[model samples]
Target: MDVNALPAGPASPGHVLEVLRRGGPMTRQELQARVGLSRATMVERLDALGRLKLLRTVGHQASSGGRRAELLAADEVGRCAVVADIGVSHVTVAVADLTATVHATRRLSTRQDPDVVLQQVLSLGRELLAETGRANDFCAVAVGVPGQVDPTSGANTAPPTMPGWSGTWVHDTLAAQLDVPVLVENDANALAFGEHLADGAPSTTLLGVKVATGIGSGVVFGRRPYRGVTGSAGEIGHVKLASHQERCSCGRTGCLAAAASGRALIRRLRSSGARTLLDVVRQVEQGRPEAVALVTEAGHLLGGVLATVVSIINPQQVRLGGPIGALPEFVAAARAAVLDAAHPVALRGLREIAPARLGDSAALVGLAGLTADAVFAPAAVNALL
Candidate 1:
């Protein structure tokens, strides 16, 4: 095996690393077969990667006749991401590996101010990184906010739920602190990506809706999230209902969130001692008359928006999350409404109206994944090499 034998261009060291990263540990012969590289080329790449301490022999495989070949892996010795999932009520910070394997995590309540929330993320992220022994690993910083973001700059846009967040340079702020690449994503979009990963990374389109304090949705087209041109692809909560003229937080009338979101529901049940979305969900589970009525109506309204979503995009899977969306009763109502209102052709490709597989941790998982991908991508690897 010789380094000079490896051709230029696509046969870069990054290519060999990517193969091992995606396909897992394999013998040099197996890797050569997979990359269709000459033994000399393969050995050169392996030697290069080995010198960089990015490739290593993990174990040995069974042999046919000669000595067994050593199974080699992309030695991701200390790589990890510091990630945050910033929700309306709380923020979850964690240190995770490229596989989204969380090593340490913490959750804390926070105020509405973007500065306060981001500060919380910064403190907790550093704390977890140190706790998990990933403090020195300079990977990416990914934060998922419950709001819209600029696709290119990763700045917060005009998010109704997060006032004063619009135009905020989330990327700059975090990048200044952590000194690494930063990714700011809508919380629902992060959840969507997390759910996509949780479902074995299916090569099918998925729509993920979160019905929390403020309703929102995320779209995943097979591999990655669909941010759309304006970075508001799945604005399900803001869908205007033709029947209702209720004022939405976005200062728009007839938006579905105005009529059906947990915020709206809590406002209606304010005098009833409903302080949180969980309070409303408890009532629904208890079968309280008002709670059941309001949630059922909300479910129908949510479904109506989803029906339009289904008709337009026709995703293979629809994952409902958050406190209200995950409720079996609410899901049933929404499912029935989608079935009734959606076009037959649209429904043909649909699977089930399922609850999110990752639940509360979805956003964190997604953020970590997004961070790891950017940091460990083939291009990134090539640049490093």
Candidate 2:
């Protein structure tokens, strides 16, 4: 976790990859400056990385003092990863390289059995790798589950929907099955990391709000996902939002998720004679008063919870993801509630509230980044070379 600990020897390939990851293709001088290494050290590192096929000189840059220096970049296709997002209803898999380009993706309906789902994930990953023609290129696998995760042990401690997943050694089980290193993380946290890396957010502190089958949030500070002491820092769903007394999946009453989650919305809609979320959207678009009222109510409830989030984190911007967050009517309602309820100081200098750019694939993209980190960790890359 210490960013300052640069690996030893000339074969510190990950340093070069890390430099290219953060700054894109850089000249040798730029690499030396960014990596804080001497010219000889930088050259050795680049050479070793190139030899390992992790980094390569892709082009040349203009120079004033001499011939243009070769520009170094990651050889993305040479070192790949498999990423999965295990949601309540489905599991999405993606194959990505070191630079995080998703080469192939697949999604499968999920079952209540965790063992069945794990097998499906492995099968889907293999299919994706075969499609990419890089079945052996992968170095690691990363999975995001909608639950509390112990990062060190990679165990799913408590998941609301996944009954038998709790206390399961997910990383170890998957690693043993796939014969690769694996990392398991909370789904929301994974989405937050994905958004932070892809959205070009300005603040080191980021809050990602996911409003799908369930409501949840993720916080990333100092360039790392922040899971609090008990790995429940951003379980905003469990926070009380209503006094009307409705039970949550966690056996708690008045939980925000019970009031505003997609499942809640769907339940309400079904009760009111609407069949699906698409039906609600269609009715809203056609100016149905009841549909508009339902979405707006959900949004208002969500915003009331987010007002507290904004008050505590004071993030530069809040990125909303999942089906509910992308709805225009829902977004407008939530924005209105936040502006009306949250403190002025928290809103000061706040940037725009927007839907996630990656859409439904955000968690998978995040898992790809995590896989890259696990595979190309300074020590791992050194061992590979």
Candidate whose TM-score is highest:
1
**Count of steric clashes across candidates, in order:** 0, 0
* Local distance difference test values of all predictions, in order: 0.81, 0.76
Name model 1 segments beyond 4 Å from true.
1-9, 51-53, 56-58, 75-77
Model 1 lDDT at residue 205: 87
Give residue 197's lDDT in candidate 1 (0 to 100).
81
Q: What is the per-residue lDDT of model 1 for residues 232-260, given as tens digits with 9 covering 90 to 100?
A: 78877787889999999989999999999
TM-scores for candidates 1 onward, in order: 0.91, 0.89
The residue-by-residue lDDT of candidate 2 on 1-385, one tens digit each, is 2223446654355756666766778887887887787787676777677667777678888767877878877766577788888877778888987666788888887765788888888888888889889887877788888778865555676557767777756776787877777788888898888887786653557788788788778888776788887777788888886464777888888888887877777777886676655566677788778778878888888888888888888877677887777678888888888888888998884575677778887777777776776676667776665
List residue ranges in candidate 2 displaced over 4 A.
1-17, 33-38, 63-66, 201-204, 273-288, 383-385
- With a 3 Å backbone cut-off (N, CA, C), the pairs that clash in candidate 1 are none
lDDT of 2 at 340: 86
Model 1, 324: alpha-carbon shift in Å? 2.0
